[model samples]
Target: MAKNSALIEPRLPRGFVDSEPADLAAVEEMVAKIRHVYERYGFDPLQTPFLEYTETLGKFLPDTDRPNAGVFSMQDDDEQWLSLRYDLTAPLARYFAQNYQDLPKPFRSYRQGWVFRNEKPGPGRFRQFMQFDADTVGAAGPEADAEICMMMADTMDALGLAGKYVVRVNNRKVLDGVLQAIGVADEGQKLTVLRAIDKLDKFGPEGVRLLLGEGRKDESGDFTAGAGLDPAQIAAVIDYVGGKVPSGNEGIAELDAMAALFASAGYGEDRIRIDPSVVRGLEYYTGPVFEIELTFTVQNEKGQDVLFGSVGGGGRYDGLVSRFRNEETPATGFSIGVSRLASALKLTGNLSSRPATGPVVVTVMEKDRIADYQKMVAELRAAGIRAELFLGSSKNMGKQMKYADKRNAPAVIIQGSDEREAGIVQIKDLAEGAEAAASITDNAAWKAERPGQYSVPRGDMVDFVRQIPAVAAWMEVNARP
Candidate 1:
């Protein structure tokens, strides 16, 4: 049969990629650790939908000029614009407002889900990515922000990144104060200046100076329009980012309060520090902002040594929920970029990159006795073993073995007519067999050792399979809460 000429190509969009089993497993592990920390801090889990009204996301959409600017969106049949959430915080604001009457005064919640962005993808950037966030709504004190910073530090410690990461805290108010002090009143120019300051780490002082002034061009010759700040304004912004923290303003007072709380809570500068440069990129941040930055240096794709920078960040957004409600609803939270953090962990050798093991596959040896093989699988499953009966067209033992190996299955169960008559079943430990094959050079010895193949009573098959070292270890690890 001739294949259809117009078979659509199988591919993902540039900014997205499929998560394989191992990748998923790594993310799951990281998320679990983060969840435990959040729960320990008394944050309950809350989940919002993947889509929200375009306006509900606040400034991301509903623009007739560029409906999908920075966010994926579409108009519904009823002519209402809906958009995939760009971040978890916006949805949380909507949710909190919608359920304000029933919710507690200070609603503390944590959520983890995928967020979508309609932006250009680059190294470590994706159109769809997972973020694990914890937020406290209705909390107006700087202590709330301090707790978030400390929680972030604890989360890093929980992830085995104890001394390798630091929670850098700052205040948007402080940045605003500096801008005010510099006599920059235009909101557009203020945002441009803040964005320039945010790039202090990515580009050094000179690069940021260019961004604060005329503009800067990248290695690809792409020009980015700057804040158009005068020399004096640029110098002022640079001086502030260079650790000359401003005082006397509410921002400075809040930072001082947060710093006191941090010291009282025993989080030293190594774990959590008051950094003057951590002005988060988000515009909604009304006050304190913080970021978790990995301190360890790693070689980039170009083999250049660079610090694995901010993996996660968040800040107080006192105005987000107010858009939904008539009253002021202050909120503070932090988000961990699951994919980026996983990548960092893998590079730092903290995240496991091992191939995921598959379930135990029971081979269908005799077509007529397929029921018998299935029964064995059921027994294994009933005993809490991950087992599945192989159902494929080829009945050849070699093909069956190959399938089992490809699955990375710890072992495979076989019950042929002869073995059935003898009331015995064979279990092959694939991992052990591969290891033995590599070490045992002689075919004779390989056959004699039968390294990982075992014949046991039919009734004891489940127990024998469970005893395989690889299977045993996997079960033990998975059995934990």
Candidate 2:
């Protein structure tokens, strides 16, 4: 007798998700649109490995205790520590540094891939997610930053978010000046201040003030230690954040310069604007930073309406590649969280509501006549129609129809003995049947419409199916020449 086997239950790690075909299709559609916009702006596609040497990917994440603190890391057999890339930008920086001599100046490239981070996951916050990035490396002027802002606006418009979103722009230099004016010059303290400011939308001004001063206790009574700044320092930080100080004035001026750059290129404030509160949470950003925020409001779990918030952000990082070489290499780019953006589109009803439909299924009525069914499926496929033959165990007609429905098949090719003897095939429009059955009130009219099924000669089966409006429209869009 064989020993009893142990069955292992399949599971996915927290913050990771598996996508179904419909979800995958929807995401692919969104990515294609974004990629089109990037390509239009002359950005070429590039890809990098999921893993990189820990030393090669320099430590730049904000609020981390160590270099690989925020990333998933593992040790190789050769006693070298490797890490999963926390963001696409880091790998790009490594690539540029390694091949600087052979690459073009101001190398323009776009990449779309999954990035990993090791962090506590929350609602809509995953450890692994897709990011689409476009960067101009080696461009050192505000013009490059302005172009990125403009391209971000265009990308949003391409994704059908033209009037519903705004790109908030700011500069790190202005923030640095603000800190200098406030007497809070410590590097760790600056990060603490940035993090507190980042919580402005959630904690509000008063809560943030508490955080900047002593500390803050949330509604759940969990305390987040403050930056330990005095009252005067807190006031200075708050005034700068509110754009009421000299350094704040300098930040506003820089934003105005960027806005003018955009306007000269014909982009207006409708798409991009300067906001002092826009401090991106990344340590590597040395110059201007911008965030794409959706202006629309949605209800949260607490049943209160709130803004959709930022879906993407980027800024100039001149020091990333400087770590590799002794010289500064300016680069700026933008990245959109693919899943979050898709979720926003869905919530706003901008995404397609219909689930992706599968191919038409040719039912197997006569098991002995499987060859005939295969022939019909082949003809449909050859005519640029998506179709498949039933390859199930059940031979019952009712079961076959149920299987077709389960497959989301638009229609089913039926050739029973009677239809075969009549030298014809039946094309049962399952979609039409469901729609008609749901709405038809008059039995006589329903019978007269014959909305569910049609019969055509065996030789004309493909042509007849092609004439159906739904199938015809699909073919017009997806069929190859």
Using TM-score as the measure, which candidate wins?
1
Candidate 1: regions farther than 4 A off? 1-5, 60-68
Residue-by-residue lDDT tens digits, candidate 2, 364-476: 98999999999999999999988999998998988998888787788899999999999999888887887887798889987787678988899889888887666776688
Candidate 2: segments with Cα more than 4 A from true spot: 1-4, 245-254, 440-450
Q: For model 1, what is the error of residue 17's alpha carbon versus the real structure, in angstroms, after optimal superposition?
A: 0.4
TM-score of each: 0.96, 0.94
TM-score of 2: 0.94
lDDT digits (tens) for residues 209-307 of candidate 1:
999999999999999999999999888888889988766888999988999999998888989888888988767889999999999998878899999
Model 1 residue 461 CA deviation in Å = 1.1
Best by lDDT: 1
